[model samples]
Target: MNRRLFLAAFPAVLAAGCGFKLRRFEDIPFASLYIDAPHGGAVAQRIRSALTSSKQTRLAASAGEAEAVLVLGPEARSKVILSLSGAGRVTEYRLGLQLTYRISDKDGRTLAAAEVIELSRDITYDDTQVLAKAAEEQLLYRDMEDSAARRIMRRLQSIGPGPAS
Candidate 1:
């Protein structure tokens, strides 16, 4: 029993000695931030929900009221046929989501340069399961949006406050 216990705990002890730690959410620097994106957009909505849950930065109702403004460029989504069946039917498709964003202070000084985050997922398709495949495509797009939101949050955490004007 003692040997079995030691063996079970050995990995944990080794990890602790090596300082292995799980990643935790880092706080955003701004007290409040305004997101400039189209209303009811998927990525924007995900970002807003995340920030609200984090409670690190308040979401400003307007750009004028925030310490910093995050401007999101138009979101573009695409679906391309990556592979086709021998009969020329669609066998697989690659779905993509692209979004560009920049951060600036209330004074309009750029804090972070405009950057694009693009994500794609390849999905197999079968004509017999049209409804299921369509549902899968939507789920993939939603997953991509969630990932983009996390990336945006990380980018925001990396931005330090700009010099006082």
Candidate 2:
């Protein structure tokens, strides 16, 4: 029992000693923000999840009620053939997601103008594994959405909470 306990604690101690820690989002100046994305927007949903994780930020009831407004444009997703077999069957494809957004004050003054973030992943597909490839594609899309949201958060952090003059 003692040996098992020490074994479990060893890695934790090493990580602590080496200063290994999880990445933490930077502090934002605003306490609340409104996400102005259309319903069923995947990128918006991901951004909302990230903001909710941070106790410092909260979603306002409406754009007018928030100190800051994040305007999210439509998200576009595409799959392009990256490679084809001699028989003209797609062997590899590049899956992509593009998201656009802007930040502004409640008064409609733009802080960060329209910015687009894109993410892509190359996947090899096999006709024999259609179901598996479909699942993989779904996972890739989810990853892209999460990545795009994180990028937007980093951009916002860099711009700070100050309004653009």
TM-score of each: 0.84, 0.89
Model 2 alpha-carbon drift over 4 Å, by segment:
1-8, 163-165
**Candidate 1 per-residue C-alpha lDDT over 67-111 given as tens digits, one digit per residue, 9 for 90 to 100:** 899999888999999999889999999999999999999888899
lDDT of each: 0.90, 0.87
lDDT at 165, model 1:
59
Residue 26, candidate 1: C-alpha displacement in angstroms: 2.0
**lDDT, residue 148, model 2:** 84
- Highest TM-score model number: 2
